[model samples]
Target: MHKQLLLIGLLLLVLTVQGQNLWREGEMQVRVYVENQAQADFLKRSNMIGEPAGAFIRCYLTPDELLHIRQQGIRYEVEVDDLNKMSASMGSRGVPNGYYTVAQLHAIADSLEQNFPDICKVVHLGFATGMNELKAIKISDNVHLNENEAGILFDGGIHGDELGGPENLIRFARDLCYGYNNDAQITNLINNREIWIYYCVNPYGRKYMTRYNANGVDLNRDFGYMWNGEGNSSGPFSQPESKIYRNLMLNNQFVIHCSYHSGTEYISYPWSYRAQSTPDAQHHLMLAQMYSQSSGYTNLPYGQGYNGMYAINGSTKDFGYGALGSISWTIELSVSKQPPAAQIVPIYLKNKAAMLKMVEMAGYGIQGVVRDSITNLPIPALVFVNDFMCVTNNPVVGDFHKFLPGGSYTVKVVAAGHQTRVYENVVVQDNQATTLDVVLPRDTGRYAWRVISTHIAGNNPHDEGNTMGALGPPDNIRYSLGKNGYAIIDMCDTLKPGNGPEIKVFENDQTPENYMVMAGATPDGPWILMGHGTGNQEFELEPSGLQQARYLKIKDSGTGQSQIPDAGFDLDAISYVYRPATDTSGIIEGFTYIDWNVLIEKAPGTEIYYRDQVVYSDENAYFRFQADTGSFAMDAIWEMYGYANCPVHLSPQQHLYLNIIMEWMEPVETIAANNSITLYPNPGRDKVAIKSLTNNPLLSLLLCNAQGAVVHRIMNPQMNVDGEILLNVSTLKPGLYIVVGIDETGKSASGKLLIQ
Candidate 1:
């Protein structure tokens, strides 16, 4: 009898510890400030992975921890206990009154299968770590068989206390099954797409009225992406709940995925570990906009995650995108975890359209097959259109789908050890899917440099949409102040080519400024500063212990002396010399212009006079003469349609500036014709030698500023003096200027002059 009493005492102690594991209902939760990754790391060591609050991060702390934080002089405040709440307050709004019991949910699933056997099937998707069954209701025309149709998976209740998740998913499934043939759009989506609806992922937590699973783990934070062995879970996939979903992602091809939650009305996208733009940013933004517009919920702007609500690592949405390449999204369904019972149905009805629309968009792009030419068998490959985006074919079926805006695209198919195939002028029409089947051949040549992505920062009005290979010294240059501007160049694969990593940037003219060169695998980088230099010059970025790198970000360091106002480092062309570049002439060239109106002016100026106003027409360029300070701002405004149009605003201190400046005739034209005036060593450090190619004696030469104001003049220069008439250009500031020469025969020629 004494032993039995001792066992009972131990059992009571275990129960008390279990109670302490959970956040108490109605208990106040405080958000403690974390200054940097170090402070965040401290909080993370204490199990606060998903509770990021503001600029840096926020640590949700217990009362004792809160006091410790205060004592440590850490800033903190008590906000609404988002996790803990009164049970009586739950389901108080006009929503489903009571939470679903485990048995009741199973019964509902069973009923769904029984009632809609033709289009729905209930399947048990393994079990959570707590041993609670995870269930899903799959709705499709042929629910029992696998189809080539696009697949979409929707799941909720990854957070146990967020009842809106499971309830909304359950209701959406029920509505889809019920409205299948009766509703036209529902019938269309069901027939075309395979939909999987998973409800109540954390059943043990839900059953016990807790915020975590039976093991006190947050299932949503247990994915492998950015999982740092912190938070409530021991490691990635440590919880069976996360393992089940991970398995599902690996085994099936889900084109679209959504994870539902509550506490805010938002639709969040990826890069949860760090704030970076998703690789499929455009597609994610388009679909997110569609979902938000259809549901009328707040759409977090593109390139932002969780509405900057928090910095959560190892999240479900991030895992789906970072690992599986699925276009995943997170939906914060309501302001409360559990809204009033009466509001549940209303919320379900409101989000119904978005749920259906998301699935529809999965199949609304170009879909096709990739195959082996010799064997005539399906082969997995990558499909690229619009240089920025790429989609891979399924391994089993060799099928690929790419959603794109309506336009003519040159679809390129690439596979390992295979010669890439290019299809030209493949038109993708609105609401139509274009099919293109490609068969790759064996490659016969050695590997070479291939551009993966390109990004530029500054006010460049043209050539922004061009690929890295197509960008060069002839293209429009982006000019900004100091180190405020930058560019990102990505390669097709990481390069560790033994020794001497070389990078080259081609500029339109010689303007010296220091640039910070960095290398990494991603854009939001823990960047490594590799080199710093002036002007457009070749850089060697070889550093010790750093071998493989696929991304290069260049920032203006503003270390070199500059004669041009606010002129940072400008790049016209860039290349990574991995294997001695084979071709360097694909550099695309366009007319350069500056638009003065959009310039972010530092000081007040008077509107001088206007010449051209229409975009990219005869008057696409303008000159703004600053009377207050004898400086001119030249702007090139063009209707280049799809190109990045950055308004050119030249600083007053920059003497040689033009809003729009393009050579009327090619420089080579002067060489082709005998009647030419040549300026040797165009970017002269001190003196420039000018020669008259024709027999006519040199008449007069006038040097004018960007605004046509004469800066210097010379008359009757002796022909062939010092082999060529040497002009002193050391007094002139560095910038673009005009050189006009007139002969005795009334013949005249004008050429661009560069002062360096």
Candidate 2:
């Protein structure tokens, strides 16, 4: 009898310990604060929102989101208890550890390493605005997982006001660590792909209880894809918080990005450029459906700006995917506020399972950014494109988007006052940056017939598109016809609409050169030239309407070194416009989300081109292109019945690395030589001086240095002269320079200036 009794006691002790361990695994150490108990009571009342159980009504609120409950004239804050916090019977610095304070939550960061311990590092991402070190413990077990993911970026709490996200992320991380050994799928994802997670993208915003970051900038809307800072200034790139993130994003090769946000429940993607249904709209919607089904979350009205929720600019999602070429999405957590610890824990557990699966479920594909052609700024707008057309409402907590199946695609970004920009056949074989910078013309395309802008400037006898007159970036110069040289130069700032009649290019006899000046109401100008011996000459009508009466220096393509002599009958007109039927360039007109096996080969470094621009491509033959910013279609210019046309298609999320093959063609090169002039030193190595006999004033001088910076200037911007204006390049370093001259009227001419 005594022996049996002792054995029973031993068995009971074992059961007691096992029971304690189970209790510990399911502990809910949380605290809530209210102005009084009234508001807390109200939250407690709503706590019965999701599901019900004993002891906890489910006040599903992260501290920040919980704070919102105060709208009823009440105040509140919430927190979760961690094991480390349970150890310090006394608060570390006024706050006890046995109780989870914000500090202890941070302390847990050191514990979680990468998915593959040997491959990545376990470290801190950055700090929040409150200066709280936002810590993360990445548990990378290469022995269990392989994480060379095309790239993955995940962040939470950009809107300090949206607190649930970060808190939920914490829960997600916690569950992953504790459940790793038991969870088979979780282990697989971590090991196979490289996943970067930043719990609390903007902690300062949360601590201060403000919607913006430390610098008062909306961290969510800072990338300059289609950025309009004055309208939506999150902060300058110089902000420490922003800089830290910017540095990471710019360097990250992650293919997909998921930013957590609250106040609404939805999975929005693409075409934030103008809040419109992109060519890939359906496709993106499909992916959102998948996320919704998997995560048990709701999808709200996405892609709507201030027009829907509020008209804002500089959103991270659009910028990340458009400018950086990363597929990005904004995951709005819950439709309701915070629940109690018991309620929150289960919800968190559920969400963790859902999101981990969602990330895994979001497949691969091509993604990129849509920036202002001139400013290189990110614009907050909807995006659309073809190949595997996709449209996602991406939130910018950090990374761009998920991995791709290694392929190519065409992307289009649209917004007001900008041209219908298109990128044809962009390829993404691996993690490569396809900095597809898009140029948007001012919004009046309706009053605007067309935009014939170019990185290339038309003739003054140098190359295909331009002379020294229209030098590209690194230098912002505008040019026109001038004396002693084919093109005259001017400053960018000083040259605006109707600001010309400033530059003069006259004949050797001081006679206003025989030139007929033609101006357009918009960029797609019906240009009229007044000179002789005209031949092949390229021209670009600005995408935006022309500042009245702008002029360009047009000298003959020149058969010889001498300026083409006028045969007296020298006046012709030419006009180029968008193929006026479908209001587009080319469209993807197909499905996105391709399978890798369909790809020709998993190579890298291939290229996609539209007209003369190399827009997209990868090593393998995977790529797509865009034509309409309004539609996600690309410029796959196909001609029929003497007119060129392109169709528009939309994309969906989860349908990444699309195998959507596009069909496109080139329009026969057409240049109507209205009228031409003359120039000397045709290919002059040292100083190929010029003398234009055209009668147009210089408006702007677009010049570029060897490093692509504008080096010289001739302010008036008019070439109503016929003499020599030596370009004093003694200050210019020895290298190739593109010198340009624009008349006060906006006529341009460019040439190559070499320095030995």
Candidate 3:
């Protein structure tokens, strides 16, 4: 009897821990009648499923919730009394036989990548809460490269119970890959555009057949924009799934993005949290019309999400449009959440052409690259078309595409460390893309240039002002860091510890408010507190023990009332105080090379370290910085391995040039045996000579300090008849240095040199 009781207790505990599935034994699917947004909000508070539609909202409610609805005097009609039984009658506890399971879908993607190696490649997005790998298939001509091409994304299965979406996505991906060479339209699109299909976003939810993920949080409501603590979301993007999704969107500049759904047949666009239409309302409507017309359905209703369906915060559509400016939306495929197995193919067939049309239209707008005028290299910039704003370019390729109606409009380009450029009356044509390449000169001002791409704006309920106000110059217009609110801004250029004050904070108006400022090297920061201040003030970075910082976080000190307009700290702007280069400071300019030959392409993003300061080369592989005159060891790092050089002595007001060549680190034993180079006067100071024993001529020599920093370099040195190359090491500090020599055939030889 005791053993039976223990067994029963364990069974009950297991069921309790699992919480709610798609349908419980006594749960009922009901249509609730709501008079206004207030009633809709009330239903949401009751923890109901799905959003409101027109005067009625369909949802699954428990017996207790149904009784509460009656007590609240809300009218509701029961659609399905026993949801579990009804679902069982449709098929089984899991998906029907025709529907593909999560494992099967992943297998299909893997097989496609294997079969079509040229155009299809599987990209591992991230792991889900259940430890299942989230994957996306990229379809393009050059699948491996991040080319300057318009990108589009399609994703499905955010809600696990909505099964049709994943099926549609996987099928579409398969079709695109198979039709690449056979179909002309598909071939053209595959050649010109980069298409991404993220099938099965919520693998845990799909496997369990539940609306929520493994943690029981609704993935759809966990986005970071205008989040209001709905659907058990602990915070904005708190869940792993949402974090991975956010990274994908921010990393790629996708022109058009579509998220699939079921339980309703409609097309919904942005402004889901508010009633106001998006600035590109006409453009959204036009695309919706085109998509619907191309699809199998006729007269498919489409409109703004707020009224078209219902108001909701932290939705993927809103995040994609409001934050990143992608043409993003959700497509409701069927009236049934999980339709019968046989209807899956017909439903996919209905929307296949419309998906292709979206890919085609994604390139039909204004497309261009934003670059630096001086270096002629790509840069990330904000492109504003009249009133509609979008982050146009990415740092990798610096290409941007925006779908616009055919008309004349003002186009403004803004970038960090660059002057804002405006093009008046930039005309775009119908069904065709217009090129508007822009080159911005460097900005000499000291003001903070741009806001970090991603951040949580902990806005107060009453007065949550725009964070963009804190960017650019000091205008009277400011962003209010509401009671205990905060924001992160980017300086775009590194700010170092200078002679006097290195930073300035501008508070709007005469009202002085308390705030704390912190700085970090990256956006996700282990922040070092700068100081606390009231109102406008100048701060010195020297006190913080930080060598340099490019990102700043400012927070209100929670001194003001909780509910008030422009409460807490009102920040007008933040800037770096520039001091003229002194005679003690010396400038170093150089390029990072992949090979010793100057004709070869330069390597970008190589890290150059001198003393406590580190800087990365730009897209053109050029790096320039001014540092205080001193004898310091310099190191060039690539892929976390340091390549050493001789010590450098920077004289006052000296202008030095360097070319750092990155080489792979070989085994110590192998490096000593191969190439066969010898160094003489190992313990002597002033100079070192390198003589190669190999047949190849020694073309260049690099002398490094004990710390593996390249301190001295001799390129195209005059080799004697005995094949010996001399290096002037008089300026190098007395230490054990490593000498690396490059042969004419690009082979490398290494030897140790002791300078005393």
Number of the top TM-score candidate: 3
Better of 1 and 2 by lDDT: 1
Which residue window of length 10 is worst by lDDT in model 3?
452-461
Q: What is the C-alpha lDDT of each candidate?
A: 0.59, 0.40, 0.75
Model 2's alpha-carbon lDDT is 0.40
Model 3: per-residue Cα lDDT over 1-756, one tens digit each: 699998887687567545544455477878888766666667655555555443467766779888888888888899879765654454543666688989899999999999998789898888987566899998998675555678999999998878989999999999999998899999999999999999999987787676677777888888866665666787667788998997788777788899998877888998676667777778889999988999997556788887764667678988788766778999988878788888999999999999999999888778888875533445667677776635547664568888887888888777755788889988888888898887786674456654443222333445544555676667676878777766666675677776777788999588889998888886556578989988999887776788888888787898868567787798898878543222357888888876433444577887776544568999888999987675665666555332434356678888989777765444332333435556654454666667876767767777766445666678787878767677777887786666777777756766556676
- Order of all candidates by TM-score, from best down to worst? 3, 1, 2
Per-residue lDDT tens digits for candidate 2, residues 1-756, read 699998887687556533432112323323333434464345433421111111122233334434455456543223344322332232323222122335545655544443324433445556554345665444444422212233466777776645566677666666666656577886666554456667666665554344455455566545443333421353324245554665465545445667777554555565443434433445445555555666644433444232132223345665555434455667766644333334445555546655775556443444344433322233333344453322322211111233344456666554433565667777765433343434464442211111112111111222111122132111221222222123211111111222112222222222223333234332223443432322222232222244333333333232332222331212122212222122233333232222233442222332332222344344344455544323222322112101112223433221223343332211222111121222223222344344332346544454465223454556754333445443444455665555555544433444444454
- Compare candidates 2 and 3 on lDDT and give the better one: 3
What TM-score does each of the candidates earn?
A: 0.52, 0.39, 0.71
TM-score for candidate 2, please give it: 0.39
Off by over 4 Å in 1: 1-20, 23-28, 31-59, 68-97, 296-303, 306-309, 374-377, 382-390, 408-425, 441-756
State the local distance difference test value for candidate 3: 0.75
lDDT of 3 at 518: 89
